[model samples]
Target: MRAVIATEPGGPEVLTVAELPDPEAGPGEVVLDVAAAGLNRADLLQRMGFYPPPPGASDVMGMECSGTVAAVGPDVEGWSVGDRACALLAGGGYATKVAVPAGQLMPIPDGVDLVTAAALPEVACTVWSNVFMVAGLQPGEAFLVHGGAGGIGTMAIQLASELGAKVFTTGGTAEKLAACAALGADVTINYRDEDFVEVIREVTDGRGVDVILDNMGAKYLGRNVDTLATEGRLVIIGMQGGTRAELDINALLRKRGAIIATTLRSRPTAEKSAICASVVEHVWPLVAEGLVQPIVHGTMPLAEARAAHALMESGDHMGKILLTT
Candidate 1:
């Protein structure tokens, strides 16, 4: 098998494709002949030595993939050899063959092809768990997501809007904002030129938004609180801005808001399995019905993963970047 590994923590140039031993399925797991892998910001962070995979996981850089089942281990049922599936992985997706827990596997959605299915698992589970399960976003409420044109943001906007929430999002350019609007975002703010907090407040008649899905962490912490409606929920899933910030306890208390910071990669396998199940039950139907879709920017060969990483870091792509084996 060939896998991409970082020689050392640094730039995209550090990554190289090399021969590695093929993986075999363990109990309750399945071995996949990977068709394609999705590129994520976390992959870049791992390459730079800022993020490491959880203990006992693979060091190869990838979080999600779609492939065919080449083998299944003992205790696994309802899946078999030759099945086409996509999975959310803890690591090791940038390879020709990888082993995954059977519970993390999902059949490709009705309308999506096998290769494009690679783009769904990570973004779907992330948005569904944080926005609906944790934040409890309800119909008719106002929802806001930062980085509206990226993978998670694009999925969040469509899902929230389809479920009856009035969606708001922030992007850095007109083209990005336009893409968000076409995906059902009711309000789009250019973060480069406008204050999102004020824009959100004005759009909602000063009541603010009921839920906010944020990726900027410390950079937007204070402003996110200011933009939340009373009893609002704010979920932070990324730290592109920084990790530390001061909180205005009084402001949060006055609004009765809740702040939660979370990451998907470190979660226990059982929890991830449960989230995958929930996504299949609640979100897959929307995708099958054409109400939501995977937004992929482009696809590259697995050996070109370094170029994919460079593109993601450039922030020029509008959606997910994929690497095909």
Candidate 2:
């Protein structure tokens, strides 16, 4: 097997691919001959040594991949060699092969090809678990997601719209905002020129939004709270902005709003499996029906993972970037 590793904690230049021994499946796990791996913000953080995998997970940077099952461990069931699947992983996805817990594997939605399936696991599981499962976003509610043209944002826009929420998103450029609107964003704010809080406030007739999926962390915290409707939920999944911030408890109390900060990478396996199962049940049907879809920007060879990381860091690409084996 071949894998990408950071020679040192620094820039994308530190990444290098090297030959390594193939991983063996453990109890209740399976090994995949990877078809493609998805680039994520977390992968860049891992490469820079800010986010390490949980204990015993491989040091590879990827958190999701699509592949064929190559081996299954004892106690694993309902999967076998040659099974085509996409997987959520704790690590080890930036390789030609990876070991995944059996429960985290998902069948490809009808009509999605093998490689594009790599784009679904992380975004689907993250959005479904955080927005619907935890935040309890319901039909007729208003929803907002930051970075509307990125991997998670695109998926969030489509899913929230398809599920009957009035979707709102923030993007930096005309092209990106247009894309988000086409993907069903009812309101698109140019974060550079317009304040999302004001835009959301005006569009919701000052009721504000029922839910907000924020990635900017501290940079948007105060405003996010201001934008939330009474009893609204704000879920923060990334700290792309600086982490530390002061909270306005009195303001939150007035609205009875809730704020939650979470990460998908560090979740317990059983919890992740449950999220995957729920996604299959609730999200896959919409995907198969063509009401929701994966947004892939482009593909690069697995060996060029360094370039892929650079592209993501540049923040110039729209949608998910994949590394194909």
Candidate 3:
């Protein structure tokens, strides 16, 4: 198997492709012949030594991949060799072959191809679990997500809009904002110039949003609270803007709002399985009907992991970036 490994804690230059031993399926697991891997911000964090894989998991830098089952281990059911799937993973996606827990695999939706399927698992699971399952966004409500043109943002915008919520998003560039609008974002704000909180408030006529899917952690915490409608819910999944911001408990109490912070990578297998099941039951139908779709910005050979990482870090791409094996 050929896999991308980090030589040390550093920049994209530390990534290199090398031949490595093929992984085998363990109990309740399966080995996949990987078709493609999705590049995520977490991968870059792992490469820079800011994030590390959970205990008893692969150290490779990827959180999801699309592939075929090559081997199924004992205790696994409803799967066998030759099955095609896209999986949410804890690690080890940047390779020609990788092992995954059986419960993490999700069947590809009707209109999606193998390589593009690689882009769905993480974003779909992340957005579905956080925005709907946790935040409980309702139809006819208002919702906002930061970084609207990125992988998770794209999926969140489409799904929220399709489900009848008015969608709001923030982007740094015109092209990115326009791309987001094409995907169903109702209000697109340029975070570089306009204030998202103010824009959202004005758009809703002084009533803020009912739910917010925010990745910008502490930097937006206060404003996110200020942007919330009474009894609103805010779900935070990333800390790209830094962690540890002060909270205005009085304001939150006054509005009766709730805030939640979570991560998909560290969840137990059973929880991930539940999230996958809900996604298949709820999200997949929309995807199959073409109400929601994967937004792939580009693809590169697996060996070009370094370039992919650089491109993702540059933040110039509008959607998911895939590395094909």
Candidate 4:
């Protein structure tokens, strides 16, 4: 099997395709002949030595993939060889073969092809868990998501809008904002030119948003707090804007808002499995019905993962960049 391995902690140039041993399924797991892998900011961070895989996990730099089952291990049920599925992986997705826990596998949605399904698991689980399960975004409530044209943001906007939430998103350019609007975002703010907090206030008659899916951590912390409606929930999943910041305890207390920081990679397998199940149950139907769709910017060969990383780093893509076998 050929896998993308980082030679050292540095730039994307350090990533190289090399032959590696094929993975075998362990108990309650399945071995997938990977068709494609999704590129994410976390992968770039890992390549740069900022993020490491959890203990006892693969060192490869991918978090999600779609493929056919090549083999199944003992105790696994309802899946077999040749089943078309996508999985939320802890690591090892940038390879021809990967062993995945059965619980982390989802049958490809009815209308999605195998290659495109690679882009779904990560964004689906991330948005469904944070926005719906954790933040408890309700129909008719206002929702805000930063980085509205990226993978998670695109999915979040569609899912929230389809479920009846008034969706607002921030992007850096007109093209990106336009893409977000076409995906069902009701309000699009150019973060570089506008104050999103003020926009949210004006759009909602100063009520603020009930739920926010934030990727910028410290930099947006204060503003996110200011933009939240009373009893609002803000879930932070990434730290593109740095990690440390001062929080206004008084403002939070006055609004009765909650700030939660979470990461999907370090979670226990059981929790990941539960999230995958929930996504399949609640989100897959929307996808199957064409109410939501995978937003892939482009696909590259697995050996060209370095270029894919470069593209992500350049911020030139509207959605996911996929690496195909």
lDDT of 1: 0.95
Instruction: Report clash pairs, candidate 1.
Output: none
Model 2 compared with the native: what TM-score?
Answer: 0.99
Clashes of each: 0, 0, 0, 0
Worst 10 residues of 4 by lDDT: 302-311
Candidates' TM-scores?
0.99, 0.99, 0.99, 0.99
Which segments of model 1 are wrong by more than 4 Å? none
Please, what are the lDDT tens digits per residue for candidate 1 over residues 1-325?
Answer: 9999999999999999999999989999999999999999999999999899999899998999999999999999999999999999999999999999998999899989989999999999999999999999999999999999999999999999999999999999999999999999999999999999999878889999999999999999999999999999999999999999999999999999999988998999999999999999999999999999999999999889889999999999988999999
Worst 10-residue lDDT window, candidate 3: 197-206
Local distance difference test, each candidate: 0.95, 0.95, 0.95, 0.95
Q: Tens digit of lDDT per residue, candidate 2, span 161-269? A: 9999999999999999999999999989999999988888787789999999999999999999999999999999999988989999999999999999888888899
What shift in Å separates residue 95 of candidate 2 from its native position after superposition? 0.4
Per-residue lDDT, model 2, residue 300, is 98
Q: Candidate 2: lDDT of 22?
A: 94
* Candidate 4, 231-269: lDDT as tens digits: 999999999999999999999999999999999989999
